[model samples]
Target: MATYSEEDYLMLSGIQHFAFCRRQWALAHIENQWNDNYLTIAGQNLHHKTDDPYISETRGEKFIVRAMPVHSREYGLTGVCDVVEFKKDNNGTQVFGKSGKYVPIPIEYKHGKEKTNHSDELQLLGEAVCLEEMLFCHIDYGYLYYGKTRHRKKIEFTLALRQELNQTVLEMHSYWQRKYTPRVKPSQKCKSCSLRDICLPELLNRESVNEYIERRLSE
Candidate 1:
């Protein structure tokens, strides 16, 4: 496995963006353009609540840790997990300064209801991978908590999913190395994207310069 220097590590949360749209990922992470829409704002607020560094508590056999900073040298990624619960398990590994063996279960909080996309799951898996590297333990699964549903959905860290995550991180690293932002592909999904105005997907899709200018002037 290869290790990344501190400056070369990409954000773990960027898995969601990359999964959603390669162009979107490059635009934000490469071009350094960002504009928050309502959904993004709400999501940030929700994460802020859960990302407090001082929030940690013990409940019976479970110890809850909030805003746990995690990174993976193998994947060249770094980010904070919203919450991580260390559950007591007879077969688990020991945590320093804590009493018994425990397994780490990462939980991520999302603002909206669950969607058909694997973005959330991928992000959660990234955290699990980071935890595994930091703690020297195997994580079988993690959780995604949706604010709208007020529920946490379990996600198994399958071989296929892990492979996909590895591929995604590899792609991200390639793009970062070249500082490349992918060309836009316009679609119905563009309307919901927070960076639509900055991306100008519609303009990029226009076949003629006159048509693009006309559309832009009209808007």
Candidate 2:
């Protein structure tokens, strides 16, 4: 396993963007350019409500912790989990100042319905893996709470997903190191992309006016 120093750590949240579209990830993460669309704004608002770092609530055997910071040196990633529920269980590891052993299950909050691309699932898996590394415990599953659907979707950290997540992170690091922004690949995803205006996928490879006119006249 390749390990990266803390300085080389990339944002864990970037996995979603990278999984969705490599160009979008490059534009936002490498170039540090971000434009807020409706989806982005809604996600920001939802996170604001769940991101109170100081908030922690106890409900019987479970403790809900908001805005818990997590990182994995092995994976070279860092980010804040929206919610971490420490449930009391005999199989769980002991926590500081806690009465008994507890298992940490991370929950990520996102906007809109579940995407077919599995970007959201990859992000949740990243959080779970980070928590597993930090807590020295095994995490079998996590949760994704969609604002639009108003439901929680359970995600299992299977071997396939983990492998995909790891490969995705490696690719993201390669792009980050070279400061390379990939060219746009036209797809339906471009319609909802916040960076569509910035990317100009259609015009990026456009022909000159003379060439266009010649092609049209020939047709």
Tens digit per residue, CA lDDT, model 2, 15-98: 999999998898889877788999899999999999999999999999999999999999899999999999999999899999
How many residue pairs clash in all the candidates, one count each? 0, 0
lDDT of 2 at 11: 93
Per-model TM values vs. the true structure: 0.91, 0.91
Give the Å shift of residue 188 in candidate 1: 1.7
131-196, model 1: which lDDT tens digit per residue? Answer: 999999999999999999999899999999999998889999999999877775687778889988
Estimate every model's Cα lDDT from 0 to 1.
Answer: 0.89, 0.89
| Candidate 2 segments exceeding 4 Å error | 206-219
Looking at model 2, report the run of 10 residues with the lowest lDDT sum: 204-213
